[model samples]
Target: MANEVTTAPQDTRKPAFWYGLPVGYMSLDLLPPAERLMEIINQLRGLPEQERDEADRALRLYAGIISLLNTNRVQECALGVHPDDAGGFTTSVFTVSTLPTSGSAKLVVAGLAGSAADGPDEGMRPLELPCGVGFLAEKRSPAPRSSRHPERSDAASSHIWQGTVAVAAPSTPELIVLQMVTPDLDSADDYRNILLGIARTLTFTDPARAMAADEDREPEAPTGASAAMRNDFG
Candidate 1:
């Protein structure tokens, strides 16, 4: 069990966008049960607006939904990291989505679609995987992802198969969003790691590239993570 996070570095050349976080939130209306999407929006609305005095608001970015239809399967979930509570103002969230490497979050996410067959009570849990502890894995590719267990151990704790969603400009041909339900997740960072994995899983069809692919698309106009989401996602 390692807790190191790794991001792929470009070949001395940066993409238009960081490939870490997206320009803003995305909608999965193309496919879904409808209600599921609504749940995501409510979750975002539920987030406390006021900054807590105790916990250091280390997080600068967070992903949330404005409103979406519910669905049987997760078509998409508004995903992003945190820089500040405000919707826009910082590009930090973009960094998380654009991460060149997969990091622990991406590995877990890419493996999820395959792991879904083992019933619903197994594998990485929402709050556990992204927030879990592990060493970061580097890659020869431009973007590298960290391995979850790398070592032999007691499997993962994700309730649903999850992965990091590559943060690409909404303009991409297709995009993915994901979220999880677990008792352990308690902070924006926790959500970021898990969501990042979901994004990671979507980057490449090939397992290797899939693991390293971060933001596969280009960046959109700068509107900050949250603010851009409010307008784009809706």
Candidate 2:
């Protein structure tokens, strides 16, 4: 079982993003890119044969989640554009599990301009937000049925909703991408609303200025309130 907790950054000035997992859902601390790769490698070493396969599958899923939130690079880019050249992009990921179901979800916010101003072409619908042109689309797929129980026909589907909130700027346009996957379609709207709430909190900050401020400051502990929340997972 995974350890779970409700965690958030201490800085209120920073935007608050949400995954709408049960309030106390477990939070996994992602290692910085370089360290995470090595950690995964170490975990795979010398596992019992029976446990190796399960470990591999879980690690792969965790790795894909880590890649989606790549933040160590000089620029934060989302949906294939850099925030400076485009605007800026920020991403957050969360792990969610309900009884027999478990999975991860991600939110990517990007600054857009020029040709990129137009959001996704298919299944797009308008969204009303104070800062951007917003639209949302939901995608679904049948969950893999159990092969052993081929005769059991009741199977749930997974859902992902890609929502975009494009802010119209004469020079720099921006959009927010909320991609969420859940075990069933019934909760898709709930997750959509959660992402929308987070997007509404979005505000543009000058990355250059933020970097300069960091340069002048002394190194500090990580963002979360507790050390456990700051501990990186293998």
Candidate 3:
């Protein structure tokens, strides 16, 4: 059981890549980017003056990075902040992009692996996600190699951690690739678990129809206002 890959109950619906946000993660609006940026800036109004200034600068820089990704076919980006016991914070980034051509899931995995197999990192393995069978891999920062002396490589004291997952979009020729990066390797297992949860939320169903289904399942509220009038007095 320990060696098996745990997954969520299958959701047999959708023709689009609609996924749910994981806890502590905020999704950025990609439909014209600026709309979401303004929303985030407004939320910083409650912070201390100095902290707010610092956060503003950082947010602008991050927003620029997202803009560059949008030019490519990246559909979504999310940021997660987790508080630690040591009174500090750890952060992670997640992005989803659709591949250019249509192909089977096996072909998609092969293409992803062929491109990164040369990188120095842990090996890739089969991952059983709710969407379907997929592949997962962890990548580490490469040590800087000398340009003049290609034979000699500089040893790096530390490196960053990144995780990638590739799953095919159901009923479509598209393939979706998910990538996550974090500075803290100590919590790699926990981060991986979060990635698994996010992957399970993926579906190829139409967002409009899926949302309508959810509304249909919701319980109806009390009809009359007279039965529910409790405002500091019975």
Q: What is candidate 1's local distance difference test score?
A: 0.32
Q: Best-fitting candidate, measured by TM-score?
A: 3
Q: How accurate locally is residue 110 in candidate 3, as Cα lDDT from 0 to 100?
A: 61
Candidate scoring better on lDDT of 1 and 2: 2
Q: Score every model by TM-score.
A: 0.21, 0.41, 0.59
Candidate 3 residue lDDT tens string, 122-232:
557667765577778877775345576665543432556788888865655656778888867787787886776667555554444644655687655411211111110
Better model by lDDT, 2 or 3? 3
By summed lDDT, the worst window of 10 consecutive residues in model 2 runs over 97-106
Model 3: pairs clashing at backbone N, Cα or C within 3 Å = 14-204, 14-205, 15-204, 15-205, 16-204, 16-205
- The weakest ten consecutive residues by lDDT in model 3 span 1-10
- Please identify model 1 stretches exceeding 4 Å from their true place: 1-8, 16-112, 117-234
Task: Please write out the lDDT profile of model 2 over residues 91-173, one tens digit for every residue.
Answer: 22332111111221111222223224476544445555434454455556565575766556364333233433333322222
Clashing pairs for model 2 are 4-26, 83-87, 83-88, 112-173, 112-174, 127-134, 133-166
Answer with 1 or 3, whichever has the higher TM-score: 3
Model 3 segments more than 4 A misplaced: 1-15, 33-63, 102-106, 110-122, 142-157, 206-234
